[model samples]
Target chain A: MADPMKIRATASGDVCEIKVLMSHPMETGQRKESDGKIVPAHFIQTFTIAVNGKTVIDAGTGTSVSRNPVFGFKVKGPKAGDKVTVSWVDNLGDKRTDEATVA
Target chain B: MDATRRTLLRGMGSTGLLAAAIAAGVLKPTRVFAAEYNKVAFEAKDLAGGLKGIGAASPAESKDIVLSAPEIAENGAVVSVTVASKIPGTSALAVFVEKNPMPLSAHFQFLNGALPEARLNVKMSQTSLIKAVALANGKAYMAQKEVKVTMGGCGG
Candidate 1:
């Protein structure tokens, strides 16, 4: 099982700021170990964020991202008490889903 | 019983399960998943090639697209980048780091009137030009900024 993602959603006036921190290795497949073996490419391929079950952002990421990636966003429609869920699928078919209530 | 050995054992355990799944026909390996990773874009040496790899032909320079990043990155391994488009009807946003081994970092698609904004952390091999491209009404607009890296990222 993958580690749980950390998500925060704060509403200010009409916009809600959402921040996420994902725990991942984000290996680019280009790096080699001390034994001179190439590490296979293993990274998050797709990331999605939804508010109240409505999709807001769908992203495609590559190995170039840093380990334990952090993402932020601003949405207009969501208010306090709305459901905000963030999920990601990695290259190895591993999936993680976590959610936070809009504050 | 070191950390490296533990990690290796864990990796081997996952691989063993994957092999077992394949043998049991629980997971049918398909080309769809394999083709999802854009190898060409990641291998592109220049900005034009990277853009071409992602299917953005000629993006016009625009000030409406905001590329928020620090002028100096204290840590290149986790530099915060945020791209927001002020253009109406924006649909997509892509980020590229010109100096990294791979230029194309992340691509985002917005649907159902979602705001054209994305914030993510990227690794920079060194000081590089960070570019943001916004697709609005099928037209592409780009904005870029320079970020100096005090410490090298990307295994440099």
Candidate 2:
């Protein structure tokens, strides 16, 4: 099982700003181990953000993203107390989903 | 010695079969779901190929697309990047590190009620030009910034 993500959604006026921090190695296959073996590539491939059960952002990322990535975005309609959900799936089949309420 | 030999043989046998299947186009690189992940764009080796893979071969330069990145990065492992598209009907946004092994770093599709802006961190193998592209009304626009990295990040 992967670690849970940390999500924060704060409303300023009608726009709700969201920030997320995910935990993952984000290994690139090009790296070599100290013993000369190559490390397998493993990274988050897809993620989705939803506000009040409505999908707002459907995204894809490559291995170039930094390890334990931090991502931020904004949505226009959500007000305080609206539910915001986020989910991510990695290349190795690990997945995590977490949610926060707009404040 | 014999046990190690047996394990090695077993590994090779399975990998050989998997390689054959992939070569014959019987399997893909294994995507988790039907999310809007474009395999070709993420695997493209160069800027032109990456742009074409994302369905924007010749995007026009636009001022409405803003790319915010540092002019000089002390560390290549984590460089902050933010892209904002003010185009009225912007639907998608893509970020590209021009010199990375795979130039395309990320792509995001915005649905109704979402803003076309994102902030994230990306790795660069070296100093390179980072480009942000916005798609709107069947057309693509782009903005780029050059970031100087003092240390390389791709190699461990």
Candidate 3:
């Protein structure tokens, strides 16, 4: 549906963290096709990140954003070796989920 | 066949690409332009289903989350972007394209909320909007903006 996802994380002076990237066009539904048809606004309304099955970051969106977005956040109480799960949904009702561990 | 012609162009070099682009312009602009619609249409199901994995989130403005990108990009083909969230309960964070082929472009979920952040370069076919939704403390909050792509990045 969108694009392949990429994820990265690191230690900020002894603090471990992770980051992620997703592919999307992020249409605002206000544009038109070459033929002059209205393209409806379609974007991921919200997404979540979990570490060790616990919640850490929660966010949402509308049409006032750019496509192929990136999200960054940090979590403490974890070592260098831990897992993080990420997921999202779009305006057209599309969805994607991917996970990676912190290095 | 149209498929053959498209494949031939795909197989060709820059010269072929230019010639094909010219041919496409003369033959059918609407069909060529609508090709990206298939991308957005196709990613719909996967994006919708993926978002449902998490139930809810608690919203908070964490100085931990940092969004980095050019305030204005000369080209949208591969605009670099990065996000970082420094919070304890950040289980997952995701990015979305409001008007791309599929809305849910990518997602990052961790075994624990101990680490949540990411960086990537995404392709924008035209001037469009983008969004990022985060999950924390069982609630959700978000940010959004617009990006202008100078040329056609989505494959014609």
Residues A1-103, candidate 1: write the lDDT tens digits.
7789999999988888889999999988777888889888778877888999888887888777889999888888788999998978676667678999999
**Candidate number of the best lDDT:** 2
In candidate 3, position A99 carries an lDDT of 78
Q: Residues B41-86, candidate 3: write the lDDT tens digits.
A: 2345333433453332324444556666666667655666665555
Of 1 and 3, which scores higher on TM-score? 1
Q: Whose DockQ is higher: candidate 1's or candidate 2's?
A: 1
Instruction: Report the C-alpha lDDT of model 2 over B86-134, residue by residue, as the tens digit.
Output: 9999999999999999999999999968999999999999999999999
Candidates, ranked, DockQ: 1, 2, 3
Deviating ranges (above 4 Å) for candidate 3: A1-4, B1-156
Top candidate, metric DockQ: 1
Note the Cα lDDT for every prediction shown.
0.81, 0.87, 0.56
Candidate 3 lDDT over A1-103, as tens digits, reads: 5665786756555566556777777665656888888876666655666666666655554343456666555666655566777776554435677877777
Say which prediction, candidate 1 or candidate 3, comes out ahead on DockQ.
Answer: 1
Error of 1 at B54 (Å): 3.0
